[model samples]
Target: MNIPDIWRGLTRSRLFWPVLTLVALAILNVVVAPNFFSIQVKDGHLFGSIIDILRNGAPTILVALGMTLVIATRGIDLSVGAIVAISGALACTIIADAPDGNNPGTVVFAVAVSLVFSLVLGSWNGLLVSVFGIQPIIATLILMTAGRGIAMLITEGQIITVSSAPYKVIGAGYWFGLPASIVIAGIMFAIAALFTRRTALGLLIESVGINPEASRLAGIRSRGIIWTVYVFSAVCAAIAGLMISSNVTAADANSAGLYIEMDAILAVVIGGTSLAGGRYSLTGSLIGAFVIQTLTTTVYTIGIAPEITLVFKALVVIAVCLLQSPVVQARMHRRKAAPPLPPVPSGTITTPVAAETAGVAS
Candidate 1:
């Protein structure tokens, strides 16, 4: 309620900057494209730039949601993109070769097969890092490099297109006046929120991330926690892959989910998860994914060059990152001769460094 308390609260809110950035982008889009905010009912489904952003960003949001937990476990998964490729490749291949790709049963079976494969791949990463004591980055890097090759082998270096109506519904179809992708992402987010907050898993993950030795001493199964996160991350990526390939009805082993890992990482960082790992905010990551998708939409709306669009997006991201950085904020406050803001409150689920410095780390 006091001035400093309010200031600290504002500064520590993980959702603040990402939400502000998203709103700013929306305004900018509206300025550039007056109809950007307009919503229309097409075949009983809502359609608009805003809806498109949510629909398109759903996969990234799903991936970032899983990455948030992985980072909270003091780890990362660079192979998400590759997993995406493999998932799509496997599913599409199976469907393509099916006697009736459009059969709902066939689509279901394909999806199941893809997810099972993703689980195995995720377990491989987990085994290397959790069981063999390999560093997370390096362990995941192995898969990151080789996963594409595996996908290529599965697809035989060809793009496999399918025409499964049920499969298409997973990505491009509309349901109940909204995008199916959005619905899927929302369900995934809700399940994650419940699995973590409504249970003790979230705390244990954070405890391990902050201090693995301490968590182990307390009898927490640190290895299992780490392995479970990796597996979950992979499964999330597989879902994203299904969404991507389903939207197009094609799987390109070379390009399916290409570079999505970087986008997911950026979304997580922008949403306030620290690469160093600890506490995390799935809400922030969700907003951050929207921010990214909105930025991409803005590029075309504002008539930015195709070649330089990435540069523009990168510059914006850099600016946002700098603005949200504590080091930069501290310097700005010092220049203004303002008292330093109080540290983020204990048990706050914002990011890593705040928790790390507040003795969350050993």
Candidate 2:
């Protein structure tokens, strides 16, 4: 209702700092590029820096959404990037090998195959962790290392290209005057939000994440939940891979979705989700994805050297993490709550000895 109350409410919100960072980055972009916020109609489609941020950041957002769930269940998927590469590589290879790459049926078949293969890859990770008792990180890292090689083999160590108009629409076309990628991301976000929030799935996930042994004791199907999250994460990465390859009409196995797992993990962390597991925020991950994209855009817009861009990004991320740290927040609150020194009376004037005596007595 008032300034202090509003401040308190904002500080209490998990999304407060991430939203603020996004706003600050947007303001910075506006200052650097006068037309940064300006959107215009181009060929009946919206075009602008903001649109580009959403469109380009869509894949990361998708990956982050799934990562949020996996992290909530006390797990991580380092194989997401590899899955991304494999998805794109497989899809492009399928289309390229087809006699009619542009045929809608062929495109659909390729997409289906890519997604199905991604499921298998995801199941592999799940099997290692949920069934075989391997650590999530180690289980995923195995695929992370081997996925690119698999993708390379799929493409025969070459970039696979295709010209399927229908497939291209998935990533590069416009839908209802908005980028198709944005639409797809939005739809997936809604599905994830609703699927978890509208059902008991969210509570079960939090329960499992909080204490898996306890959950299993209570008959909560902990293993199934863990396996499901990994599978879901893999599917998300596959869809992202499809969008990326579709956008460029080509798939470079070596370069596709490189280091994207890092971005997705960063997004989940920046969204205020703890790596320790339990409790999560999809909305926060969405904002964090934008934050990452905005930061990347800022680096290029500010003309930072290529070699220094990573350093600059690291600095900003470190600052943000520190600000979000509980220790830092507690210190800030203490300073805010500390009482001010009592003001001296208007006519009061004390000699040095008197002041010293008063100070000592107090």
Residue 269 of model 2 has an lDDT of 88
Model 1 misplaced regions, further than 4 Å: 1-8, 333-362
Candidate 2 segments whose C-alpha is farther than 4 A from its true place: 335-362
Q: Write the per-residue lDDT of candidate 2 for residues 1-362, one digit (tens) a residue.
A: 98877887687677989999999998998899989999999889999999999999999999999999999999999999999999999999999999999899999999999999999998999999999999999999999999999999999999888999999998898999999999999999999999899998999999999999999999999889999999999999999999999999999999999989999998998899989999999999998899999999999998898889878877877877787888987776664456788988874655888778878988
Full-model lDDT, candidate 1: 0.91
The 10 consecutive residues of candidate 1 with the worst lDDT sum are: 328-337
**Deviation from native of the Cα of residue 356 in model 1, angstroms:** 48
Models 1 onward score TM values of 0.90, 0.92
Model 1: per-residue Cα lDDT over 1-362, one tens digit each: 88876776686676777888998999999888899989999779999988999999999998998899889988989999999999999999999999998899999999999999999999999999899999988999999999999999999999998888899999999988899999999999999999989999999998999999999999999999999999999999999999999999999999998989989999999999888778888898998899899999999989999899889989988988987898876764453457888898866867677667767555
Best by TM-score: 2
Instruction: Locate the minimum summed-lDDT window of 10 residues in model 2.
Output: 329-338
